[model samples]
Target: MTVEYTDCITLSEETAELAEKELRENEATRRHGLQQVRDWIVKNPRIVHCRDDENFLLRFLRAKKFSAPMAEEALERYLLLRQSWAAAFNNMDCTLPNMKHLIDAGYLFAAPGRDKYGRRWIIARPGVFDPHKFTNEDMCRIHGLVYETLLEDSESQVRGFVHFADGAGVSFPHITLFTPKEAVRIVKNGERTLPMRHKQVYGINVHPSLKYVLDFGLSLISDKIRKRVKIYSSMEEASDEIDTNMLPKEYGGVIPMSEMIEKFKEELMAMRAKLLSHDEMKVRLEMFSEGARVGSVTALKQGSALTCGGRTLDTTLCGSFRKLEVD
Candidate 1:
């Protein structure tokens, strides 16, 4: 039987039990929390424009362990980061030629089935892409597209997911694709900015020379995120941490990578309109500025220091790559 793509994600009995136990999520709690966050959004005037629908708001709530206050903060940051970082968040249309090209290369894909632990696997193979043709920004956009699609499923939002960076054929050109600053910002944002319950990060088949550079990037992230990272010398070692059966055949699973890539492509095509609709979600910084009387729209556009909507924004809340992209 062929697996058809659908937005509704089903969790296994074990995974559902885990969610209730760990995430404090249940039918009753979910209903109450949804209303709580929804009401909070209505009361919070600074949160001007956003996808206030229950599905969208639930992502942040789940990521922040169902805490209304934390979810509000995260949702605000999510909007601010999208507004501030044009390179990554803007133009998230999946049908664009550039995005389709990246998808064709299997640059990054979330596998079809859940692992033994019921967590999703996002396999990233950077070496497959032509570094000369695509810049780091293109890669960032691809990541945005993949994660956006993945986050649609409640399983991914609650049970969380694991990232596998396959370094089988990574070369110097691939390494040079990212500057030191871009590398740091990417690491920082993955942990600090993006609202996802990222469980573990495992790297395998890594080249010896790139280990130091990867280590340097890892050091910039928080200790919690850093500790979730585990690098293995071979697939056998990685299998101890991950269920290889769910990965593509090339990586020791039964399914072909091409099959996963094609399925993912179809999924993206199916989700094109919804993904494009993300462009509609924007944060009216002016409303925030008016409330705080911090800056003008002109100042916000001019990249006023730590100001959004003319108000002082916590530097850490906003993932401005340029601000963090330094030696």
Candidate 2:
């Protein structure tokens, strides 16, 4: 049975129509797309212990607009990155003390409902996490847990999602949490490696230092994503573009941010088994070399390098890294 978490809203009929029109998804396409990707995964030796369930595979297909080839590539990258960046991606235990704290504090979470465009909202209060108390990986894991769980919803896969960063209380200390390499890696993964489709990013009352970081991130992402980034002087100004009621009361909505946070924590715990199961979804990189066959095409050739998180690593050495490689 598919497990569900609270506060993660379901798809409306209007949104379902939008998904069919925008994502090219329907009953027919879903079946054909699922089969194509499933066949490729079974044939590909490098992919082991990965869940090939219909719900899981559909995320890639929906994100790629039912294109099997693109979905296959995304699936490969998703598993491969999780294998390489085990520290940040693995052992996603939400019950841990720090992880629980971040959840209770509302550091990052999915809003209770969809926006006017049908896209879900993931609000981030970076200031809630004391830079001194948590490491960059901790922040990454929290986001990874939330998004991974969110992506399980079929509507999120099709409608995609937006990010809202409440920059109130953000300061230089939060800015210091990430080194240059770390910052670049996070942006790269969010844009390139992850399987979900990212629609837009909204930030209100952003800190000057964090804006510098945001600027740096802009340089790393594609022009399409760059154009979707919207920063406002205040939440009121942001409401012009975003529906106010969809936002938390702190941001001029009817719902309280604390209420959403508590619900998100319950959602996280509800999906705990599924989240922890990711520890077993690893890639056997030996099967990814030059001669290996992924369906009809070669996965990678000898001496060919894989560019991950803006860093290039020789394909032969990709499996050796047990953690995100720091340069």
Candidate 3:
């Protein structure tokens, strides 16, 4: 017995029809709308090279409910945000040394089963969160793994993400590793960049000692997120909201965390090459195109450098799309 997610962010029949029409290019609106966005990106000197994949364009459109200009706004900000946090989001190397530590921590995983609405469940238990073992960059890198792999599905995007956050045994030490600044960055990225809908966030096993910390951290996020946040007072209360049968063994579920981790690892290994291919498509100063201007898109800004964690990132329009290396 569990509490059903009342507010699953679902794609309506009308939305499905619209997505089919616009994303598939079967209708005039898709062509006109996508072309307009492509034109905008080409004109903007800030945008170096644009990957105009029909599916990519369609994602931004679905994110904004098929509003062309709005999708453009979302896409532009997404690109800029990706550029700004390149250290946290770039180069596509998942075999890094820290990845093992991240996996061993066992803080986050995609549940093997889906909910009644077909929403993918992502569980994060910060009780095992060790800042000494991993930096925020590693967190973001693993987050990229989750983002680029698990939530990349169109059906899941349409159905939405069912988030479960367990704060049991999560003391001040665990929460502090994730700073307010980092919190804000994650919140902003989720709001502005990611093209997926958040169905609901179920907060379980939160003890009283950690209440203030949790509330304070949540305060830094948006009202949209706050509204979706449902803090359960106890395990029974949480079980009222979440299906225990679909959960891992630690949380009184059928599967084990170790099994889930193995499954995720296998999926990551299979996607390794495709992830590398994304390197060229993602925004980078090294891959910008100077002469690929299509229409009136001509607002080029001088190159700028950003330093984060002692690493400097430079961004400028180079020449054009370089050959994508897909291994």
Better of 1 and 3 by lDDT: 1
Q: Tell how far residue 294 is off in model 1, in angstroms.
A: 17
RMSD of 3: 9.9
Worst 10 residues of 1 by lDDT: 293-302
Number of clashes in model 3? Answer: 8
Model 1 gets an lDDT of: 0.71
List the candidate numbers ranked by lDDT, top first.
Answer: 2, 1, 3
Candidate 3: segments with Cα more than 4 A from true spot? 1-32, 281-327
Q: What TM-score would you give candidate 3 relative to the actual structure? A: 0.73
Candidate 2: clashing pairs of residues: 290-301
Which has the higher TM-score value, candidate number 1 or candidate number 2?
2
lDDT on C-alpha atoms for all candidate structures: 0.71, 0.73, 0.63
lDDT of 1 by residue, 1-327 (tens): 212212343555665677779888776777777777777566544556678676677788778778766666566656666666666677887777888888878889888888767788998987787888887778888998888888877667877888888888888888787777557656665665577888888898898998887878877877888899989998988887677887899888899999998888877777777777877777655544332222111112212244444465553332221111112
Q: State the TM-score for model 2.
A: 0.81
Which candidate leads the pack in TM-score?
Answer: 2
Question: lDDT (0-100) at residue 100 of candidate 1?
Answer: 84
Candidate 3 lDDT tens digits, 223-257: 88789999988777778667887677877788888
